[model samples]
Target: MTLTKQHVRDVVDIYIRAWTKQDPDLILSIFTEDATYHERVLGEPIATHGGIRDYWQSKVVESQANIECELLSLYVDGETAIVEWEARFDDLVRGIRKRMREVALLEFDGALIRSLREYWASETIG
Candidate 1:
């Protein structure tokens, strides 16, 4: 199926919602069974649904709170979507409030994300 801009937006909305709500399952729903998620530019990707679930469970659900994510911009071409976003959250593990700016490249398999690569920078605000 040809990917539409609205489809991309809907998926992105779900991603933001999942993060803000700290719902690992919701985030996982948008990915393919063998999807690869690159949380950092230079880090190894977390592959497959189970790996992603564990990562999200620990990093997002367990260690982050009061999360907020905003979609700053998005561009879609063929089966790929590139998005820029800003987020603010309390880092439970680090004991600091953080503000992050991120850009992600999402490659889609139909409506699900087959691979995601993220580049981001963050600073402690408090």
Candidate 2:
């Protein structure tokens, strides 16, 4: 497996597309065999259970369902990328979603994501 500029873009696109559709498998496929997912909550990093099944059973899919994210910016350094996201919850039960910013730090092994650390604000309601 080789890393190229196009692979990174495709991975990010797959990420956004999966998030938009709330498709767990598509989301999971972007990850490597031993991928780790972390979310920064209340100034502490919450390590999620491995793989997409755990993610769907845990928080990512649930949190993702209520909102839609737009890519704000992306910066790449070798096999990593820091992506800025802006999301809005379109559903009424979720209330008026505040514009929240999150930075996804992706670590890639080849074209697969080996790890992800997503940092977001807890104060903002989704």
Q: How many clashes (backbone N, Cα, C below 3 Å) per candidate?
A: 0, 0
Per-model TM-score, in order, reads 0.97, 0.74
The residue ranges of model 1 lying beyond 4 angstroms of the native Cα positions read none
RMSD of 2: 3.5
| lDDT by residue (tens digit), candidate 2, 14-121 | 887876677777777888766777765334333432445565544546654565678877878878888887776543335445556788888888778887888875
For candidate 1, write residues 14-46 as lDDT tens digits. 999999999989998999999999998688899
C-alpha RMSD values across all candidates:
0.8, 3.5
Model 1 worst lDDT run, 10 consecutive residues: 37-46
Candidate 2 residue 57 C-alpha distance from true site, Å: 4.0
